[model samples]
Target: MKFFPINKEEMNKLGWKECDFIFVTGDAYVDHPSFGHAVITRLLESLGFKVGVIPQPNWRTIDDFTKLGKPRVAFLVSSGNIDSMVNHYTVNKKRRNTDVYSPGGKAGLRPDRADIVYCNKIREAYKDVPIILGGIEASLRRFAHYDYWDDKVRNSILVDSNANLLVFGMGEKQIIEIANLIAFGKNILDLKDIRGTCYITKDIEGLKDYIEMPSFEEVKSDKLQYNLAFKIQYQEQDAIKGKTLVQKHGNLYIVQNPPAFPLSQEELDFVYSLPYIRTYHPIYKKDGGIPALKEVEFSITSHRGCYGGCSFCAIHFHQGRVIQNRSKKSIIDEAVKLTTLPNFKGYIHDVGGPTANFRNPSCKMQIEHGVCKNRQCMHPTPCPNLEVNHDEYLDILQEIRKLPRVKKVFIRSGIRYDYLIYDKNTKFFEELVKHHISGQLKVAPEHVNDEVLFCMGKPSKKVYERFEKKYHELNKKLNLKQYLVPYLMSSHPGSDLSAAVELAEYIRDLGYNPEQVQDFYPTPGSLSTTIYYTGVNPITGKKVYVPKDPEEKKMQRALLQYRDPKNYELVYKALVKSGRTDLIGYSKKCLIAPKKIRR
Candidate 1:
């Protein structure tokens, strides 16, 4: 019910002379469970460990890192909930104007590559202290990942940050086990076997238990080897039957254990029930609070993990593909608790996780046999084993809507429409249209071209079309005018100028100008990014075209919003460049007129 210690004064109030762990972060302190730092620190505290936080420390100097003194256990480092480079720059690599994670939405509060910077600063403050890295930045970059900003493959972050250990995925289970080992007077090197943790060793001796990946030298120099290496590592991410993986970086070995098991409903409920203040620390009250907290303060994360394996997303590599949910009673408990907050205004902004429509594993078979490593649950075609149902999700929403002060409950975390359409029960779809949608229902069909969709690990555009039709029918039956807003992307790895034109035409047929267009950003650890860098699919090893030219990338993005008067020039150029000068005349079918507009 209270915030954790952030400074020496708060530590004094708690009567703590020294801490067990000092958590260093790249974000302003927001004591909400949604924030990685709060969840990890709270779970540690729940287990009777003293933890302190140094949020957005002055990494330029060692003074701020030593403020908490030395921790008896280890120093936990995270680059907030998002990667630092993605946080600081946009798709065009332009410096972003604001950072929601920082107080007052200010930019430049945290340095670039925050995990490495913060860990290095901690090392300067106290040499030989164990540093454990987690959070999105470290988790996805835990392997030899392609850094889009650097335009090359970099070694595992363990090598760069020099951290003693790295914990990927949701760290509740791993952190507990790690703390237990440390409490027993075990050395950091002795704690390598814990699931979800990665460690470095000078020699690969005694690592025969792990599945060895292609050596760093081979993967770095040969694109085919890199592709094969990623596919093997991707398959072993399953918590159940996965073998530990080992990869060589020069003479050193980076060994990663299988991911920790997903939290059971009872266990997940306990973590959410921890003492979360549900907002930014009051110390940031004067600077207008952290912008990130404003988005989720009223919202509830009812679950974790995602089944929708969009190639551009890092969720599977981090949260895994297995779905984990909080118990119904537990979710209702959180919803009721939300009504007590001072800012409550009759709305529960959202109630979902990675994929809102997903509440359970795709099928019962997933429990006995781990999710298919080679096949997706619902991409290309829905696997026969894929059981598409949404009754449990609908029930939870109906219960939350009945809460006294809760007037409306919206699902902004996004629903997998393809899966909804695959379900035989139209009841969930009907209820979603009638109750859940807030004027517009947002769904990501990413692109219209099936080739691009295949490369992105998304379902074909036809699936989205079917879902769109069903959505319209349901809204009509309910006498509502709800809209299905499709989230579209341009310049994805497989998309060339011709593919971009198809998407623009699809948007034209839909008769709506997208308020925003997502230019495919090749972030690290994404399947799409792998192809963008290597021009080969790690899974299929098929060559794919990538949009790397800046001008070509600009033209693809411009075509998505060709209807926008400002995009006229780029649209015209894209049409001409693609050898589609036929679309550049003053005809009804033409995207733009040959004559230049004032814009």
Candidate 2:
């Protein structure tokens, strides 16, 4: 298949008088499945709709909104694959220097809140066109939640965008239903009963069998109420067991239907098979194609859904946890197609999803009863029913590596080491060290403190250590030298200066100084973000400490990379405030030097 129309000239070339739908996006259009906009639009076109793409449209005026003219059906808006705030700014709230989604890695091509800004511009241009908001920004902010950038609880994006409808989750199934209903001459508001969608209505009449969450004002006023509201929403995420949710924002009630069901293997294969040029729009050819596509152009997605629900991740909320894998035949076909690409260097970048090595549901029970509301699959401890196997995944990798013209197959997506350790079979582990690791393997051991790990819903440090030991052992047995690169985070909800110090000592003992450290980012829809906002763990209902003070946050961050010369002052202050002055000395274990006097 080829790219759909982008302008009137292209539309005329296709013998179309007007586009059936116009897709407005914050990202420069790369017609690949990794981009939600591309997947949604391409799927719609395959279903016999005339689709037009408006990527990174000018929000300052109505010109870009009218570039493709009004669609015959509706205007679809997305803030790209990520939340706009995350795209435009760093965790420290500093403006990012480059936007990989933009041509030539340009920044500031899209507004700070691209969904709201672009929708407002569209509303101004056409007062009656149906405006639909989707993608990560809309899906995560579909409810009344906290905004870290603003440091306050904010209303849902649906209320602020003034859009007629909103589609949450992966949106393939949701958007198709939306388009079908719209074509049937139903008003957008009347199509509210569809799953994986949210809409606003003043009248809550006949809205029975649904859970009513705390009002917007109540969550803003009472932190406890916010905690309760978040817990309820999280519990009701499963498609089979979830109930409809409702929240009040003044006179209007925002209604969220149950999540869409996981697509079947056949359905998923069909979606991935739709013609994708698999690159950025040709309009950006001279500006050097989108940098975002470089990493994924040759990669193959083996599955969807992740049972390893990390508290900091939105996977459960956005993609659900019921694992769905593509058939091996489908996967191999894609790998063969990758070899035919002009840029193929006989390398397959990745063969995994949210978490590599997950090929099925955590267990058979979850597939029938939906994921547990209060329990996790592999955290605290692996559940009794959890199925720990990687045979299918390893086999897929081996087959791809044997493909003609395929030089190497690398599992770039991170592996869940805890799961690997649980598997009784050692073949997967041995093969991983011998084949998968280019030089080092990446794992997220967010922190060493048990208390903090408890709040983050991560396994104990001992688990990571056990896996680390086994990794090197297998590598040694195989006569190969490889290392582990542990990804660490700072300033999580339960992390105080004490916890940061403990992490620093662990780093020192490992004889590793990480160049990059991630600060706890409180994006919407994350359990960890809820903890950061309410200062309470919704699960345990216990009060947790949050490092909100910017100076102290800087100190905690410095402790993670205490060896950096520039972070010495911050590290010293952190150690002093925590009353751990013993950590400051000329000893080799010391994180920083003694005070230096400049005369």
Candidate 3:
């Protein structure tokens, strides 16, 4: 129930001369499973390994890196739960004012490019201590990819960080293998064949049956070459059918072994059942604790991996497109334990993962073969082999609702509405409207233009409309007044002013004002970001119009909130630019008035 040793004093209390592994991260140490560092450290500890953590180390100096001392095996470095660059700056490339992962919601607690910075500092202190990079930042940037902040392509993080290896995806499978081999008197350099890991090598003679991507120099200089490289990497992401991939950077080559296989049901359940303190370290209490833990503190991740292949999501790369779930008994046990916590408020914040309704693999073929290399399970239409059932999910929800102290078990995670609507039986939908919803159920429709959705790899707008109609009908039948809040986005690739007008008009007709809209952020490792950079779809090789101009992006964003008085001018400009000025007259259907009132 106590946290692992975090300082020399704590290590001394434990009577440890040296630790087996030291975990360095960019976030405040919260021993909750929601944090990546916590899961890896606790899992290693469960296996009888002495692991110490160095959270939020001062990268400017070597002092913090030396505190934990040298480890016997290796040092684990991660850029917290989010990529450091994405965490530090906004889509506009402006530095953000607040960081939720920091104590007291402060900013600038961790430096930019935290994984590279932390790794460099560790090398400065220990010289030869093995460094293993994991977490979202390293996983997404493991290959040569675009850097939105710098507006150019950058080398694979493995080259710049000088780490011995980079572990992509969920690292339970790879880390255990690495730790065991390294502990058994094996050198880190010889551990190159492990799946879900990448390493640098100068000799390519030993590599066989591997796909070689375009050299980093070619990809960085030519947009077409970049698209081809991205397309190849995108297709070969499956664990079952994937092959080792290699990309050259100068004389050295970055070789990525196939992704580690997804954990079985029993293994996945064990990961969640690990002894987690489920809160931030007590040392951070004086600063009012870490803001990131508050949302997940009361929540439970019922599963891992997502099948919904949205182009803008990093889950496809990090978690893979496979669905891994825990047994109902395991989830029920966690729900029972939640009631015993001192802060239990009769509400379990969530009972889902990447996508809530997905409780198993998308199809039987996926379990045996793997996800298709060329197509998504659910995109323009549901694959014929797709399994559309929510019975198991509904059963879990009903059981948790019957718990002794749990008054309401809400599902706060993103629920794929298209998948929900595809289920022929409406029993889950009916019950969801009746019991699970806490006044509002949010869904990500993203946008209403069919062409834009195609570019983003989302379902068409008609499918969303169908789901919305059914949701309202179910609510009416249940005698409840719950609402469906559709999440909207603006200025995604292929979304010109014309497409933005289509979405704005849909909002006008629906009479809903979005409180917030996510502009397309070109973070590394997403198909949408590739399109934004190359101006073409990587998969199809078709040219796409990207909204990169600052003024046009403003107008597109403002059109979503056109009802607000502050957005009048921008909306007017957007409508005029799109040649939709006829709709600007005095009419109920008009988005905005022809002219603003003179003050």
Candidate 4:
């Protein structure tokens, strides 16, 4: 079949009595590698299993979920590619007006806490079916976590969703192991020991070596205990040396086994070569055809996982720290395929993953031993053991650029400036400016204050300055007028009025008025969110100031775009509060004009 069956009639056309597995997702069915549901379902189909998909089913009733009937093996559930709450709401806790993952970019197609909602609906339809939860929502929320919407700590998603198994991380290996075990007549309760999975167990007597964290009740009531639990959970995410983790939720225990080993190069290549139609299902063509597919239809995921360890990013908690990249042949073959598509417009939107420049492990030692428990690879400073090379990646990009019918290839994903600067090789940088730039290069220098950068697990402001200066120099040498768009954030942990003012000054110095800015969103499973909730950094155990007041947050956000006329009053108030009123006067170096001078 060109596409997986979404209903029983399509299933029968394939001459199947019942599917081996049915995936329930909170997104419109787009059979692309970028979507988690597509990757998992396609892999299962490649393994000779009859897999089907039901996308964005109505959680308000069991009718939509029951249309697919029961699966012979299991029901795989996910909140699509991201956490449902993050997708449904904005940083200000307001309901988002549109969902790019839905048909026609419509909101309200899926309910909030989609993983739990979908699982509950499934249980109502089939009382005894095994439901395996995977994807970002299930992976990141598998442990007891602070929910921003709820404004309180909640039990592990496994506990709330009532799924028999929870597969975390990139689930290619874990899901296959699970399918084999279940197909071989093993019960869900008997499959607790599989790496990269979580299950509930009432007994821990047989589990010999595992780390126990604070219970759900303890984390809910005590902030210190919450931070401690997060620290323990974050440190043991490595696949090689990580141990089992157990967290108590009332009478039951949530047991997460060590992460599954990363896929070998050949294995990674095979997963991407699946026979995917690479667009939304035909059923969605009537409703404007799933807006999310447009962004990634022409793009390629060169690799998976990130070692940068930015505190606000959940990639570390979900994709893990180790880099599992595909072979150059696989990436190039995918690019060649894109050129043949009917919609191929000769432009490849992106040619990277979580971090564009990271194509290999941060260090060789991480392969034998796990990533360092207490330290990051490229934060505060790049580790001495770090291996900085971009030769293979550059070669792959060069080859893709020369492919037939492919006009331009851009690197839209993030590039870690600190890691790039450490390379000491100018070839990649020179080539990037000469070839890959798409008029404007977007990078993230969230804030300019060293204190804020430290809290964010990012490099110092000086590193960004060095990178900014060099980027312009390369562009100048190449005689290209490409602009550098630095992404800025406001009101993050450890950011006070003074820090906000300092960032405004940096913006002024750059002579760049940002058109877009981001507010630090306290999403679940991020170290920044933990710090926002607990008022302490889990890694350092030091108290950090958090801006909780709505007014102060508004002022901080206003400071980012202080040039806007609408933000004048907020910026004026912020400058006054920070004791930097000199920046409000009509001096040549001032950020704003004085109140009397405006008339």
- At residue 543, candidate 3 shows an lDDT of 96
Q: Candidate 2's residue-wise lDDT over 143-229, tens digit each? A: 998998898999999989999888988888988888988977988868878999999999888987999999999999999999999
lDDT pick, better of 2 and 3: 3
> Highest lDDT, which number?
3
Cα lDDT listed for each candidate: 0.89, 0.91, 0.92, 0.92
lDDT, model 2: 0.91
Candidate numbers, best lDDT first, in rank order: 3, 4, 2, 1
Question: Per-residue lDDT tens digits of candidate 3, residues 1-599?
Answer: 78888899999999999999999999999988899999999899988899999989878899999897999999999999999999999888899999999999999989999989999999999889999999999999999999999999999999999999999999999999999999999999998899999999999898988999999999999999999999888989989999999999999999999999999999988998998888898888999999999898888888999989899998999999999899999899888888998989999999999999999999999888988998789987899999999999999999999999989988998799999999999999998888888899999999999999998889998899899999999988888998889888899999999999999889989989899999999989999999999999989889999999999999999999998999998988889889999779899989877785689
lDDT of 2 at 574: 94
Residue-level lDDT of model 4, residues 1-599, one tens digit each, is 48888998998888988889999999999999999999999999888899989999978899988887889999999999878999999999999999999989999989899999999999999999999999999998999999999998888999999899999999999999899989889997799889999999999999979999999999999999999899988889988878999999999999999989989999999999998889999988889998889899999999988999899999888889999999999999999999999999999999899999999999999989889998889877888899999999999999999999999998888788888888899899999888888888889989999999999988998898899899999999999999999999999999999999999998998899999999999998899999999999988989999999999999999999999999999999999999998897777789999887454
Clashing pairs in 3: none
Clash totals for all candidate models: 0, 0, 0, 0
TM-scores for all predictions:
0.98, 0.98, 0.99, 0.99
Off by over 4 Å in 4: 597-599
- Candidate 3 Cα deviation (angstroms), residue 451: 0.2
Model 2 / residue 64 / CA error / Å: 0.8
Give the higher-lDDT candidate: 2 or 4: 4
What is the full ranking by TM-score, best candidate first?
A: 3, 4, 2, 1
Alpha-carbon shift of residue 379 in model 1 (angstroms): 1.5
